[model samples]
Target chain A: MTTLRRVTLDVLKPHEPSMLAFTERVAEVESVDGVTASLIELDQEVQNVKITAEGAGLDYDAIEAAVDGLGGTIHSIDQVAYGEHVVEERRTLQDG
Target chain B: MTTLRRVTLDVLKPHEPSMLAFTERVAEVESVDGVTASLIELDQEVQNVKITAEGAGLDYDAIEAAVDGLGGTIHSIDQVAYGEHVVEERRTLQDG
Candidate 1:
């Protein structure tokens, strides 16, 4: 079976939880080994954050649930790596 | 001492040495454990490729020399991860 090793997500979240608490909540997901969340932009209503999680076999559903539980909504799945290792996305010539 | 665990580079190379050969040569660098090269664009003159290498402690100078030896030029150091492990770059709101 194919296993997801790492995933980067663009998420929109409220300010109540704080970035630290949001990252902690996501890191507590059963399959996550470690997670890093960075604030990209913030306004009065929401904060746009980038979250990257690494694990042996990540369960996206559970990760999504965790984010939803924290009043966060996934805007997009920016990148994903599967199989034996996590592969980082490289900037290509076509990328703007 | 700080250790560079992974690096992604934007490189331009002639067609004489195929992408496979170029990747193999970079992978053979002393500090490079593994490498993945993907062609981003190609013209009659040169091929623009993205090369990502991972290791315990990567030597950028050596990696540069290897590319230079292969008739390739490093265009840009796209991303780098330094420390205990390789960290994938996440998409931020500021990114185009």
Candidate 2:
């Protein structure tokens, strides 16, 4: 059986506007914050986006709606060790 | 058996300084960001802190050290639903 592991979704879109739109929607989840969306390359028709949302703020239904709204497909979701980030760090200033 | 579910830790200290000190250390994790520590209550000697960190950046061992370093007790660590907040909410400006 496919392990029900949480993954980080990397979305790609044909335009930056759509990608940004999608990212904005995904950031609305309660636990989600400090989301950063950047453009990668222009050589391809789709723009690349790297999203970092809180495991607490992740919502699948909202993500599906946002992706479809942007007319984009979820290219991939990379599962990182999210638990390591479950604690607080007030010493440094790292944009959440 | 107690499931190994991720939990949200709310730390209390005798002084806001120690609580802040504790929080600062927790934010260093790679996935931790947008950490906010607010004080609550008076009359008593200790301070109350509400910390929100990214699950992706949490480090348990470090948290243990920081908490111990503060010469404070964790008191209570309330388990909050961290995964539901995993999605991005670009639509809102809720600090990460």
lDDT of each: 0.80, 0.49
- Number of the top-ranking candidate, with TM-score as the measure: 1
Candidate 1, residue B65: lDDT:
95
Candidate 1 — which residues are off by over 4 angstroms?
B1-94
Using DockQ as the measure, the top candidate is: 2
lDDT tens per residue, model 2, A1-96: 011112245666767566556677666644455456655555457777665454543445566566667766665443222223333323222222
lDDT (10s digit) by residue, model 2, range B16-51: 454323555554444454344434333367655544
What DockQ does each listed candidate score?
0.03, 0.04
* Chain A TM-score compared with the true chain A, each model in order: 0.93, 0.57
lDDT of 1 by residue, A1-96 (tens): 899988888899898786655766777778876665655777889988777778899999999999999999999988788998766567788776
Candidate 2, lDDT over the whole model: 0.49
The best candidate by lDDT is: 1
* Worst 10-residue lDDT window, candidate 2 chain A: A1-10
Error of 2 at A47 (Å): 0.7
How big is the positional error of residue A23 in model 2, measured in Å on the Cα after superposition? Answer: 2.5
